[model samples]
Target: MSIENTLSEIRDINLNYLMLAQQMIREDKPSAIFRLGISKDIANLIDSLSNSQLTKLANAQMMLARFRFDDCSILNMLTSYNKDSALTNAHAVMLMANQPVEAIA
Candidate 1:
């Protein structure tokens, strides 16, 4: 189900998922992240995603729980990339990701 649905029913669960992921990542017990999958029961509810995005959400949830990266800039970065990849062409790359030969400036 959508996060909205889960949030509507189990407000604390998803919030706790977000928070606990951040906390565990901070504590460095990275392996503990997978436990967040208990909520995976709702995976079928979210829609409009390809097989890959479902995987990314699943993976992101896992990483978010595992890394406990509540303060993670990486989440923003991942969000950006995910958003972009969904909207744009596959050849897009960040400045740093470009090869020396690919540089135009």
Candidate 2:
């Protein structure tokens, strides 16, 4: 609806994502890296961040997390309704697994 509302929602999502990521990383570093599609350095940074730091970062206007896929085909395959939903989803996952993880510049 309003810009302010949208931004607030983004901040909420960011906070939740960060919290979940921290938990995931703590539970299983390798699995978290793969699931989050983040580099080891980034994962370490996220794991080390204090709650206050996470809150401050989440308060920023822009979203902190993003979709892993930029490919139209992957997006389409994931979103489109298909009779073979399991197979289609598996295919999407396979494609995403090959996509590069985010690396710091």
Candidate 3:
């Protein structure tokens, strides 16, 4: 494939990931933070951004998506078991966030 095509594919994938992240932020702040490996401050900042700002940020020619998996030990820990506890926890948090709060009678 041409360089341009490869770049275009990367751009599309990045855009898709950005969109999914934004949706997760809107749906569940804590889960988004955990999954995105971002601090609450950064998550809040992202949550507060306008759609245009998000679009501009996502559309940058080159964007860096940082995660906390740089350490081999951390990766090893998560992969030690058949199931990843971190992912399970994140999914739980998201589900809780989506649950409707009930008022006591």
- Write down the RMSD of all candidates, one decimal each: 16.7, 1.4, 10.1
The list of candidate 3 runs beyond 4 A from truth reads 73-105
For TM-score, the strongest prediction is 2
Off by over 4 Å in 2: none
Q: What TM-score fits each model?
A: 0.24, 0.90, 0.56
Q: Give the best candidate by lDDT.
A: 2
Kindly provide the TM-score of model 1 when superposed on the true structure, using C-alpha atoms: 0.24
Q: In terms of TM-score, how similar is model 2 to the real structure? A: 0.90
lDDT of 3 by residue, 15-55 (tens): 67677777888899887876676667777777787767766
> For each candidate, what is the lDDT?
0.38, 0.94, 0.64
**lDDT, residue 1, candidate 2:** 100
Better of 2 and 3 by lDDT: 2
| lDDT comparison, 1 vs 3, better candidate | 3
- Candidate 3 Cα deviation (angstroms), residue 38: 0.6
